[model samples]
Target: MSETHNDPLARVMRRYLRRSGIIHLPVVYSTEEPVVFTQPVSDNVLGSFCSVTGTGGLFLAARVIRDLVDPDKDGREKK
Candidate 1:
């Protein structure tokens, strides 16, 4: 048996991965280059929101903001 097979943490992680149905290991790499954005964010961008219920709340807020900013896209006029 390999050294990894004998490791307790490795065995546990492998079991967890198998139970989670993850067939392939993730590839991770490090880069020294500075990050660059393709497009700058607009000044009209909405401020971040903290939600108790996670992504669902954030998605709802985004939908409402989109409608408010461009109601014509949704075929409605802003009040």
Candidate 2:
């Protein structure tokens, strides 16, 4: 098994998504590059909730701040 296969955050996220009935995407990781995973919502209810609540924007801002402060931690770049 690869080292990233045992990543705690990845494992927790996978479990949570599974329990919530979210479709899981392939896990990609790299030490020299950033990894991004995108998932499509198969249910209209969840999609509507996400759009109405503006959860995506909130998540984007949080991620931007996280990356700006510590780019290496989350493998994201600061804008």
Candidate 3:
């Protein structure tokens, strides 16, 4: 019944929140502020991946750049 209820993005967001069990009504959301890198990215930090569950999982990000994850090489780091 409100003007914003007619917005397409508002409708989509409401549906997603409902499906995801966040809320049954419209809620306020905001985008995070853009970050400006103060330091140059190093190769050591570039290809690393982190665990989504934060525990109890294999860490492959650190092994990627070092070529340690190769299945044909029997998971040995390339020299």
Which has the greatest lDDT? Answer: 2
Query: After superposing candidate 1, which stretches have Cα over 4 Å from the reference?
Result: 1-52, 75-79
What's the true lDDT of residue 33 in model 2?
41
Lowest summed lDDT across 10 adjacent residues in model 2 is found at 26-35
Expressed as tens digits, the lDDT of each residue in 1-79 for candidate 3 is 1223435676676677767887433222223333456999767763323543333133444444335555354343488
Off by over 4 Å in 3: 1-4, 24-79
Query: CA lDDT, every prediction?
Result: 0.54, 0.55, 0.45
For model 2, name the residue pairs that clash. none
Candidate 3 at residue 41, lDDT? 71
TM-score of each: 0.27, 0.30, 0.26
lDDT score for residue 65 of model 3: 34
Off by over 4 Å in 2: 1-47, 50-53, 75-79
Residue-by-residue lDDT tens digits, candidate 1, 1-79: 1123434556677688788887545221122333445899779765433453466566567767877998767533498
What 10-residue stretch in candidate 3 is worst by lDDT? 25-34
What lDDT is reached at residue 19 by model 1? Answer: 87
In model 1, the worst 10-residue window by lDDT is 26-35
lDDT ranking from best to worst? 2, 1, 3
Better of 2 and 3 by lDDT: 2
